[model samples]
Target: MVRADARENRARILEVARQALAEDGGTSMNQIAQRAGVGPGTLYRNYPTREALVLAVYQLDLDRLIDAVPAYLESHPPVEALRGWTTELVDAMRRKHGLGDALSPGLHQSITERSYGPVIGAITRLLDAGKAAGAIRPDADPRDFLQLTGALWRAAALPEDRSQPMLDLILDGLTAGTGRRTP
Candidate 1:
């Protein structure tokens, strides 16, 4: 376990880095350290390079997103929880774009797969719940849910309001005829 002070410093660095990357698309370690109110050495001890820092920030975001799933499931019916997750996911994708072309194709694939692992698991759970509740098509597969999520990701680049309609359409497709159409 890290010391409390060290943990605080790391958390501050990650918070500052996440905001900085969202605003600037690319941020320097010096800037992150300065904003984090930590020395360059401290920042380096926490994250040795820009890539390391950026990846950590993105992973943190994905982890947070995945962690929200259980709460959503508890408070919402499965289809609503799925919709909420998609909306949250779109926001995450938008924030993730702040990495600003820094990731190479290979790195993007690798990182995306890693990041999507827990998310896919959460989605599978949601899909299973939906099926059990008759809120989604019985035949809906996790891969199909991923394809739908990809559509939401692509649609997120559109004006903010435009994405929801598309999400609703996809959700409609997912939930129809299992007797859970939202009318």
Candidate 2:
């Protein structure tokens, strides 16, 4: 178990790192330590490398997103749950876009894998539930769904005013064939 002071310092460091990365486009151990009101040595003691710090911050956010899945599933219909989760995912990607601006190209891949794996799994489970409930089209593929959602997120990340509309269109497509057609 970590000591109280250690845990406090770790939380401080993470918060500082997150803020620094979000606002400044990059963060260093010294910057994080200074922002956290700790010395550089203390920062190194908690996170030995920049990569380690970045991964921890990324995973922290990803875990929060994954934890929300159960609550969303419980409170919303399968299709709405999926739609809500997709919106959350776009928000996450926007956060990642901020982080990616701070991280090296190589580190970005690692962060993406660590963050997106569980997210994709949760989405797959949600899609499967929707499918079983006859809310999602029978021909839907979870991987394809994820890919399309990723594309939508990428489009949303663009500096345009149409992202939400585009997202709505995509969500409509996902549920298109699952319901009765009207004249």
Candidate topping lDDT: 1
lDDT for residue 101 in candidate 1, whole number 0-100: 57
Q: Could you report the Cα RMSD, in angstroms, for every candidate shown?
A: 3.2, 3.2
Please provide, for model 2 over 1-183, each residue's C-alpha lDDT reduced to its tens digit, 9 standing for 90 to 100.
889998999988887787788776666678789889999899888789888887787777788888888888899999889888878877777667777656778888888776667877898788888888888876667677777766766777678845577767876777888655559
TM-score of 1: 0.90
Model 2 / residue 54 / CA error / Å: 1.1
Model 1 worst lDDT window (10 residues): 98-107
Runs of candidate 2 exceeding 4 Å displacement? 179-183
TM-score to true structure, per model: 0.90, 0.85
Candidates in order have lDDT scores of 0.82, 0.78
Per-residue lDDT tens digits of candidate 1, residues 18-97?
Answer: 99988886668898899999999999998987778878888888888898988999999999999998799878777776
* Clash number by candidate, in order: 0, 0
How accurate locally is residue 162 in candidate 2, as Cα lDDT from 0 to 100?
54
Model 1: clashing residue pairs? Answer: none
